[model samples]
Target: MKKEKIQLKGITWGHTRGFVPMVATAQRYEELHPEIEIVWKKRTLQEFADKSVTDLAMEYDLMVIDHPWTGHAAAQKMVIPFDDFLPETFLEDQRENSVGESYASYNFEGKQWALPIDAATPVAASRPDILQELDVLLPRTFDDLLALAQKGRVGFSLLPIDVLMSFYMFCCSSGEVPCQNDEQVVREETGVRVLKLFKSLADHIDERFYAKNPFKVFEDMTQHDEIAYCPFAYGYSNYSRQGYARKLLHFHDLVALKAGDEPMTSTLGGAGLAVSSQSKHIDVAVDYARFVASPEIQETLYVENGGQPGHLRAWKNTQVNALTANYFVNTLPALERAYLRPRYDGHLHFQDHAGDVVVHYLKNGGDERAVLAELNTMYRESLAWEGVHG
Candidate 1:
């Protein structure tokens, strides 16, 4: 029997080191299953957001979606559940830490909506030479980090989401969970506290010294050794392999706010693959999703193509662990502890409001209380609007 032609459109937000492995894996899949043609819909993260899954689902068979958007995508019924199609053995084969409970980030309404592709968290990456010169230990607490920041010797670089993850770390350290009751409700006090801590850090951040893009920051740290410490996504290991930094610095788990508070928690960062409900080729799409999730593909992709595999087993592979010197392998357990951002249908609006709060306080030294109040109001209004719309 002739193989039926299967075409899949996969979307990725950016062409970054973090995504190289998955993209390579897709290419390999095409080679193995020649009948199935996979076309990548490449876009910057911002462009991906602007295009929206609702629009893309109409055009694509598969989508690589951000984890925070899982809830919103399911709420909109833009993607279909692959739970029934995904084999139990494939799911069972994943590393315990990588797939089982950690997979909860991809679950919505008691159903598995997507498969983890790349899992990460913000960690402190510093130049070993710089730290040696400063005679400072890897920062253990926010206060220790702040002291270093005050010395004018430490240069900090952060992504917009890094600011939020920093906030999550603070809130979790303060014994707070951003979401309550699994109903997509953010605790106002937790949000406020997180925001306030972020603002405090912003006061010390030397804006002029920081790099605007993450890759640039990695380059600065590795090439020029310009930055001493940065809150970088764990995926930096891929960049490190490119000979940007010569093992001069390493990643330290995110710092906690206080000694007795909850352990330091960073935000869960990365994307997942989901099939569009509108696709006619559901079986082929499901097979491709599982293939990408497989341990062999995950391990090979990460080791050869620089993709960060979301499977725990892939993370534990001797070859893969050796590839990047167990950077991500050492960090996966920590990444599992990371929190996710607010996932509402109005997530974009909430992110904008929260980002504004961060900018106001960080850039202009705005009052934390007032900013918190404004954020709380925005959260409430957005949730209400979502409820009415639903």
Candidate 2:
């Protein structure tokens, strides 16, 4: 007898880490339950970061989303809150085993908007062959990194959004964490130093860096020998594996900053799997999400296929360690202590525009005081935007 199969569509970022796990999980789930089939599509990483979940929800039954969208998803009611469909025990397990704030980042206004399936943040990457050739050692301090960048052996993503993230890192590195108060994003003195630090790096590196994203930087590293190291970029474990790229990258935690012995906290980034509010096949979508996020499946199948697992168990698994040359073990400290972004309802608008303000100050030498004032104004405005939009 021929089984009647129902097809479902999903959207994820167009990267090896973003696309493979979903397809692998869907294929396994279909083998177990022949009546369902899931087809996943992908958009560029930039599009995935820039596109609104509400707009994507209307077209697809499922979506892999950024954690920052939790507030927007809740305000717009674009995705199903997972509490009802997923068992309470399952949700609790996820929270207990989450890598840092990966689980909490998706829980907004006490509603679970999505299941985190991938966990990542900015970390250092280098070509060991290039490093050895240059007779340079891996950096362990911010001063060491700056020296390396000065030698033209360093490169990183400094695109608009990347610049904003780097500013956040600089703030934390200097002992002035941002978004700590309702009045302003950061203390004025700290904001000034952050800008100066960013500009100092920009001045030393090539202008081309300001236009590239992390993925592009990694792609360039693999194809050329111009840049030997990247001090910080979102870690893609796939690039560290054998035969994954033209050249394999070695990833580790970032250099320690002037503020402390610990490395500066990178902004948290990872995608969550969610069922759309408008989906007719809600039951199937939820089941598929659960299948993808399960610790056992995540540790074994998902990691094998190039996905970075959010589950703590997978991160600690010995087999997972062996495959990627201990990539997870090396970067876990960075992920567990990563900094989280603001998830307020109107935070998106502020983030969308704040990048340009920082980039302008970085490119054109200007009054950093004005930049801080502009950011503070944007922060206050975003809060008000939330009130009216709420």
Top candidate when judged by lDDT against the true structure: 2
lDDT of 2: 0.89
| lDDT of every model, 2 decimals | 0.67, 0.89
Residue-by-residue lDDT tens digits, candidate 2, 187-277: 9989988899878877777888877888789888988887888988988989888998899888898888763588878888888998999
- lDDT measured at residue 290 in model 1 versus the true structure, 0 to 100: 86
Q: Write the per-residue lDDT of candidate 1 for residues 1-390, one digit (tens) a residue.
A: 987777777777665544566567778888898888877767775564446777778888888877667767778888887777776666555435463244677777877778886666666677767888878887777788788777765555454544555565666656776655433334666656666666666677668633344545556667675567775444466654535355445666666677654447666776678899999998888888888877777777645776766787776777776776567656665676776666667665666556545665677765666766676677677777668753
Error of 1 at 305 (Å): 0.7
RMSD of 1: 3.2
TM-score of model 2 vs. true structure: 0.97
**What local lDDT does model 1 show for residue 178?**
65
- Please report how far candidate 2 places residue 220 from its true position, in Å: 1.2
